[model samples]
Target: MTLVSGPTGGGSIDDFELFYARRALGRLRSRLGRQGLLDLLAEDIGKGEAFLRESAGLSGGSFNVGATVLATRGSTAGEFVAWMDKAFADENVLLAAQPEHYVMAGQPDGAVHIVENIGPHVCSFYLGSWSAEALAWAADAEELLPEAEFPHKKASNLFLADGTVVGRVLIQFGDTDDGFTSSLTVYLPTACPESVLEHHLRHFAVEFRNWIVASTTARA
Candidate 1:
């Protein structure tokens, strides 16, 4: 990731992601406790998400891992539908639209399981605090924006149960304060195109699972 200045004086997503990843990895390795690792990863993911969101000119919403987890504590699969229904029952617009500025202002895009370990056990992931306005507007206008123009589409700030993974590339469309932003997050599992659920499971699940296992083993 080369650190190049965009038309603006700010650094590009590539620069930020690289810097963020290095810092995050360092912090992850430095921590000797599971809680410390989770905190560091959450903070790093928030910073990375903010960088990409701001660099791409989207309104960078607040980044929160705990908030996301708490929001979905009892949520079931596809529960976003129910959540959105209750959230927007009075509003005419969808939650995806005006995401940052809407009622569910601080809520993330959605929650997905990073991995299902040992059958019922699962590691959940949350990525919010980035804007999706550009994708939402683009869809309505039938216009397409380049990946560089929209960071959310090019990259995602991943938060696992235990470590963090950045850049999960996916062509996602949704509405936000800016309109409809179309872009991908940076750290995805692989180059293969998969659903959000599958992407998390493949890329972040194992890493987090291993971390948890190691932490438990060390404590024991």
Candidate 2:
């Protein structure tokens, strides 16, 4: 696959990968057959959904899995990111924060779960520290995701009002016809499990909601 590199702000990770994957898949499908492509894609989608569900310990079995695949099939990276952003925002359980990149922090443990939009059908999780131990753990984990090695940058340690280390989100922005376009790159520790990570995300969401309620009450 050709790695298109320029300013990081030009597109999302999902958009890059999805565009290439879909194109390749399309060519293969045409040569093979539509049913052949659908069958292969269906299996890939199922595996992806299962991995997410098992790793994240999500209760609502594949709520938006189908939708996610459909949107990603032939869409642009920018378009997929928009849909993903909206989909994530609409989830009631996870408190969505686009601090810069889409970061969902766990309230109870203060662990930050990092998610990145890669093209239409691909998204990535930032494992903490990128240490040998962390990579090993991820390898042994239930979800089998493609891994990339990026150079590490010193991240500012951030704390919530409650004294949790949620880290900082870094977003790259570019000029687009839609106004300003931005994509988030998240920093997180590699030690967290999908279950624990998700739990913290839910806790943070609830806490944020409560804070909003309390502030509104005080104003009232």
Candidate 3:
């Protein structure tokens, strides 16, 4: 795969998924405090398919990956949820949350049009919101279990421009004593390099952190 330079003013990970992911994890650990980070891991452990195992399950030219971030400290779940409501309704905010080479636009019918430039080829998908059951599943406290009053969750299934189902994404948030945590999962059929998945993970880290900070700041 051809590795293109990412956006200016951003550290681009062209082919260093492991290195970048480790660094991102360390940074998150430092920022969230070791105990706070441990809280995240405690929740993540033994949950559903292991990350690499899930990645290996990809077949027929498709793959999936996810990233989790301790988005904010000292904010209520309701506050974060309200912020997300406004943020998702704003196209600009949604666009700002994406990494380089990924563009998202909202449709009139509440679907999202996504264009991804994955180096070797461009892929387009229309993402429609998940049903209530799916949303609850995505917001489950455990990876593969459902939880009540999960605080917030937004999810969608990806479809080709022609309407063939291709993949899905889930963004879920939960409340903690420290604040809110976010888990972002992306599944796609692009069959891109593993580095691409890592890049998106880092993308989730940076963008969600900023948005969480913004949310708290606004409340303050």
Candidate 4:
């Protein structure tokens, strides 16, 4: 997989890995056979759902991973936030957010169903609920009280069918003179491998960039 330099100075995944991950299913479709592939995916999705349901009753820690990006020119925090509100509320927009093996469905009840095909035999799926919050400003850490902050923030607390908190995805944005700066943080189970965490961070980078672009092109 090709590596792209991250905003925080670490090596991050490039479009190669993202593209490959989304196409894994297509690559194996012929070999698995249509029925065989469906059966396999159904079994996996069922098992994954069951695992989430059972694990919902248990409490465990998670590894916090995040990625930040700067969107310069032709965008503002307010506009992005408005776009997000509609995107999360509309199932079509949600489905169009990432476009392929990354499936997102926004429900009438305001929750989202997210599924990602990470590899030929592996998929990560979950149901989550979103909320808005106010977080302290990261740029003004030294000040006694940093008035400069990300005023627009939304976070999704990932859960199981039974409402057990499995993880969280926090998205925050602040307006800049040129455009806006946004960041996304994900909390996943500690048992998850480093590669999974890295992939998620890179996923954020790609997905959010797409959303930002969409926001700009949206009919006003």
lDDT per residue, candidate 2, 1-220, as tens digits? Answer: 5447775666677777766764664455346443443454555544533444343333321111100011112223333334333433332223222211233333233234433222222122332332234334223323222222112211223333333333333322233333322233332333324343444344334433333333334335
| Clashing residue pairs, backbone N/CA/C < 3 A, model 3 | none
Per-prediction TM-score:
0.22, 0.21, 0.59, 0.65
Candidate 3, residue 166: how far the Cα is off, in Å: 3.0
TM-score of 1: 0.22
Compare candidates 2 and 3 on TM-score and give the better one: 3
* Residue-level lDDT tens digits of model 4 in 113-166: 665532222344554455432223223222112236677766566765556666
Model 2 root mean square deviation, Cα atoms: 18.8
TM-score of 4: 0.65
Show how many residue pairs clash in every candidate, following the order shown: 29, 15, 0, 0
Q: lDDT of each structure?
A: 0.33, 0.34, 0.57, 0.58
Return whichever of 1 and 4 wins on lDDT.
Answer: 4
Show where candidate 1 strays beyond 4 Å.
1-121, 132-144, 147-155, 161-163, 166-187, 191-220
Candidate 1 CA-lDDT value = 0.33
Candidates in order: C-alpha RMSD to true structure: 20.1, 18.8, 14.5, 8.5
Residue 126 error for model 2, in Å?
Answer: 20
